[model samples]
Target: MPEHASGASSKLIVESVSKWFRTPRATVHALDSISMQVAAGEVVCLVGPSGCGKSTLLDIIAGLTKPDSGHVLADGHLVTGPGRQRLVVFQEPSLFPWLDVFGNVMFGLKLCPELTNDGRREIAHRFLGLVGLEKFERVHVHELSGGMKQRVALARALAADPQVLLMDEPFGALDAMTREHLYDDVQRIWRDAGKTIVFVTHNMREAVCLGDRVLLMSQAPGKIIQAFDIPLPRPRSIYDVELVGYAARIADALRGTVGGGVPE
Candidate 1:
C-alpha cells in the first residue's frame, strides 16, 4: 500500500455522482450513484467494460463536465470547474503540431500565469527530462513515434504541476512493446512526483500494474462493483506471476460484471 492509501487525507472526493445523456431518440443513464475517493498521492484506476461511464466520472472529477445529482470536492473545496490544481491527459497525445516537444510542454505551463518565462521553461525542461524526453526536446510531433508522443503528453500534464492527475486511457493506442515501456516510465514518474492520479483503463493487467487500488465498474449506468487493493511491491512488471494472478482474479470479477469476456 502507498503511504497515503490509509485515507489520512482525501485529495479528491466523489459524492454520489450520477450522469445522464439525453437525446431526442433516447435517454441514457451513464452513471448511477457513483462514489469514490482518492487519497493524496495515491493512484486509483477505474476499470470497466465499454461505455461504463469511466471517462464520464473522470471528467466530472476534473470539473470538465457537470454531474446531474452529485458533486466532487478537491482539497475540501467543491469543484465547480476546471482548475489548475487538476489536469487531464486524454487518450490521444493531442500535442500541438506546430510546436516542438519542449514547446508543447511549455504550453501546459501557460495555466500557471504566475511563473516567469524562465521559470516555465525550467519546469518544461525538468518534466521532459522526467519523461526521458530531454534529448528530444527539439523534436517535432510528427517526427516522433506513438510512445514518444504519449510521453510528451505526460510531460505536458506534469509540467502544469497539478495536485491531481486524471488520465483517460492515455496509453490505450500504443503497441504492446511501447505500452510496456511506458508502464515502467509512468510508475517511476508517479513514485517520484507523488501526484494523486485517477486512471481509467480497460486492461486488467495495466490497472494492476499501476494502481494502488483498482475500482471495477459494472456495465452501462456504471457503478463501482468491487475494489481490489494491490499490495504487490513496485515497480511491478506486467509479466510478473503474482501480478498476473491478481489480474486474473480481477478479470473474473470484471467478466461477471459485464456478463462476457474481458481483455487482458
Candidate 2:
C-alpha cells in the first residue's frame, strides 16, 4: 500500500475487503484483504490482467456485489446495497431497446424520485447535451452506433446525479478512433461534473490518460499492489510522449505481476 491508498480526506473507503466464489467444481478466491480510499471528485483507475478481480472490486464498491469479508463505506456510511448515490456504466450500454435516447436517460432519474417528472426530464436533456447527444434524444438504441450508445449510457448515468460513478471499461468495444474521441469527452465530462470516478480498464494508456491515480492489481485473489500518482496536466492525450512514459512504466509493473504480456 502507498500513502495515497488511504487517508483522512477519503470519500470512499474499502476496509480489509475480501471476496470468494463457490461453484460445483471449486471455490475460487477472487479478492484478498483489499483496502483503499478514493478522494472526493477524484478519478482513480484500476488496471490488471484478465480475471484479476478488477470488475469484482468495482462491483463491491458499487454495492452490486457483497464482499465476503470486511466492508465499504461512502461518505462515512456503510454500503449495504446499491444506492442512488453510486451508479455504474458498464462495458455494454445495456439500454432498453423500446426507449429512445432521451427516454433512456430519463429512466435513470427514476432513482431520484424526489424530483418532479418535469425536473427529471430537464435533467435528462441536460446530461444528454453534456455528452453531446442532445440532437439524438429521439434516436432508438438499435439505431445508434457503438460509440453513440456508450454516450447515451454515460448521459443516463450522469442524469442520476450520482456522487460516485463506477465505470467498467465503458469504451472497450469502440473502434480506435471512436475511443480516442471519447477519451476527450470523458475528461471534459469528469472535470465539469466533479464526480468521484472509479474506472476499471485493461488498457494501461487509457488508465494513464484518465486517472489522477492509477492502482495496479495483482492476479486473483486481487490486491492493490501499487499506486501511481499521475500529476500530469489535465485533458490529457493518449498519444502524448510524457503520458506514454507513465503508461510504459505501469505496463512493466503489470507484466511483472501477471508474469506475462500486458493487456492492451
The 10-residue segment of model 1 with minimum total lDDT is 1-10
What is the model-wide C-alpha lDDT for candidate 2?
A: 0.92
In terms of TM-score, how similar is model 1 to the real structure?
Answer: 0.97
Model 2: per-residue lDDT, tens digit, 10-92?
88999999999999999999999998999988899999889989999999999999999999999999999999899999999
Give the Cα-based TM-score of candidate 2 against the true structure.
Answer: 0.97
Q: Give per-residue lDDT, candidate 1, residue 143.
A: 99
Model 1, 7-111: lDDT tens digits are 448998888999999999999999999878889888999999999999999999999999999998899999999998999999998899999999999999999
For each candidate, the alpha-carbon lDDT, in order, equals 0.92, 0.92
